[model samples]
Target: MKDLGLIPEGYKILVTATVQEEDCDGLCWQYIHNEDKIKPEFVVSTEPTDGGIYRGHRGRMEIRVDVKGISCHGSAPERGDNAIYKMADILKDVEALNANGCEDKDAIKGLVKMLDPKFNPNHYEDARFLGRGTCTVSQIFFTSPSRCAVADSCSISIDRRMTAGETWESCLKEIEDLPACKKHGAKVSMYLYDRPAWTGLVYETECYFPTWINRETAGHVQAVADAHKALYGDKRIGSETAMNLRNRPLIDKWTFSTNGVAIQGRYGIPCVGFGPGAESQAHAPNEIIWKQDLVTCAAVYALVPSMYKGKGDEDVCQFRAGGTDTTSDKSAC
Candidate 1:
């Protein structure tokens, strides 16, 4: 495309590979850049998913709830307060929060307004597109004097999946304000991820990854859709028969998080996903990628940068005017 004068002159593409990505806990981008200083204007993650255009995915974070109490011998349980019982109360509220049954659900907290096809109490348009925020108890532990003693301290780890219009701070504050949490004096906080990379460099980062979605009418998505149509010519792949039948646009979102958590979720860089293999194949037995998926993906990736006429940089867009393409001719973008 560049040799054929399709690529603009000032643009350049830099691809990268990383080590310990699987164990980095989403620090692959941070490790590579901190080690080598690789910056970018935007990111396109070709993370494994059955070949399709993914505009965004739900964000996620790690939450820790610490409950404190007094310990006692198992024979004399009445002598001390049980932290595990307090944790059980907090857990009930957490479950009710996920189910949207809390009394203060009318508050501006983002979760209650969730709008899934199966459950939409408020009819929020954004939730209709991105689904709802979610939370669940992922891990639990208690500090006990002995195996037969009452627990003095207990902590539960919560995995929170954030939807649009939600933030890490808000989620934490919401949990802190829960009736059971306040009653139990539970300390709600976001976890910090500080693990050493294979390179032995330890970088500490918060666990909050924000949510993102590219509007279907946005220029970047339009460019990608144009490239897909140009290369694939309206041919459907995989299990897209329903989309084909309904005549809906082929854009999608990942069910699982990707490096897009850092690229777009944290940095606010424009991003979209297209890749080979199914998400089900990710981290599963007998993972595989088809040869044609790679070829098709490469063609689409190469075509997007040229098709993308970004904002505030129109001087480099040298297109053949009055021939076929006629999207824009405005100056001073």
Candidate 2:
């Protein structure tokens, strides 16, 4: 759309893409800000949404548990230590932690809200909208001397999701203090991300994505909601579930993470989300988007930059007066 002059002429925009950021556990934007040194007023994330304004999401991190053992020939298993055995016990403890609760008193508060469906909890008083925190074992591996030798080292990867009130240090501490870890002398640590971008720039950071939420009345949020209202007025493909109508309240949260993890979660910058596809379609088989959704989203995208710069009443009146382009031009709608 920007290639076709859809973005307003006076406005400036910067687009970036990341590498090795699969699973939505990303940190490219932070690198761009601190390393590449490109900072903007705010960010607009088009991550898969059910066509609603996504204000916030839970944070996530990658954790590692290392178990060490002595290697011995396979012929005599009793002669050497088997790291896999220790890992098995640690895995069981990890499962218990997921099913049960952690020792941290405050972490339990966030975990319960995330595990139970009755009520979503938030730590931030002004922006009270986020689900619970969670943890799970994602990957495991072990090292052996040879096909006939006993395994000497084993490691497991954890995918920990954080809701309000949870921090990277607290989450790591919770795992380090697990009974099995203490019994086996397992080492717990967070992974460091230092992959080179497609541009060959390597920006290293801890793999901790913080949790954040924004109020509905925030200026960026209001700009997106107002732009949609001015363009479509509750008329679009799909129902309220597929579309966020101007007639309804402008508030919702994504259960999954997005670039917002870096854009707003870490930097405290304001971020708003308005995208075409539904959240379920992401990484799903036969993912598809409605044709009309593209057109509608394009129109709204063009209007947001200009509308954001205008006074509330003046922009609404101008839009209602048809002094804007609905498609790809500077002409009036």
Candidate 3:
């Protein structure tokens, strides 16, 4: 598009995937010039979201819960205590106990989130933000020694999701306060600090995928929606944006993170998520983008270079003539 002069001048545009990796949170900055970075972050990503053109995935974090117990031998069971047996009983007890402290379901919003990879409670983006998915568990497991030495301790890690209205501190508190888990001797503890990955592309790492969420009333989404509506002779078809549906019947975002932390999550760029493959194809066996979806996705991305047509300086993306201002609102832009 640039070689053909399809892209307008006086505008800076950068395109990339959202699969960048990082090991720390000390630095962040993908698009800015080196001398321009005043802050630091860990990573950027470019995972694809099946959501229409504007919606993106949610941010996430992780923690490990270690349950300690005394060990005993299998033979001559009465002589010694069995840590595994205790843990098994505690797990059941944990599963049975209800929310003890916060009884007012009304105080908490939405549904009671059960940890199911199929329908994790944290999957729902907190009602505040639009682009990122809500927090939930992506992985869970326990550690036990081989040969069954009665197992001294146990651990289960939780993959938490973050939404516009949620924070790392709040997440920890929720886990810590689970009445049932605590009764099961479940302590809200972690081997590492609770870390939900930031959703900003403004990290210092080269591995980042900047994210955005343009409203149907704004830039590319509007333009593209307009194009589709014009083609179909109506203004109704798809939601502005949404998560990719997949084998896992959970209401999730892109099931991954992206550099969207900058444009949509930070600096507040009006962004959106639209791409060629279904959420299922991403990171799956024989992952592939359909030729038609590829063509359509290219067409859509091609429009992006010219999507923002307004006034702004070198550091800011210009808003459309009468588009929505997205800086303040995090949940639904």
Which numbered prediction scores highest in TM-score against the true structure?
1
List all candidate RMSDs to the true structure: 8.6, 10.1, 9.3
* lDDT tens per residue, model 3, 199-248: 64433331122233233344434554444343432322222232234233
* Steric clashes per prediction: 1, 2, 46
Q: Model 3: runs farther than 4 Å from truth?
A: 17-51, 76-148, 162-164, 184-257, 261-263, 266-270, 311-333
Q: Compared with the true structure, what per-residue lDDT tens digits does model 2 show for residues 191-217?
A: 887777677867777787766677666
Instruction: Score candidate 1 by TM-score against the native.
Output: 0.79
lDDT of each: 0.68, 0.68, 0.42
Better of 1 and 2 by TM-score: 1
Q: Please, what is the TM-score per model?
A: 0.79, 0.78, 0.59
Q: How many angstroms is residue 108 displaced in model 1 relative to the true structure, after the best TM-score fit?
A: 13
Off by over 4 Å in 1: 1-8, 19-26, 30-38, 101-112, 116-123, 239-248, 312-333
Q: Which of 1 and 3 is ahead in lDDT? A: 1
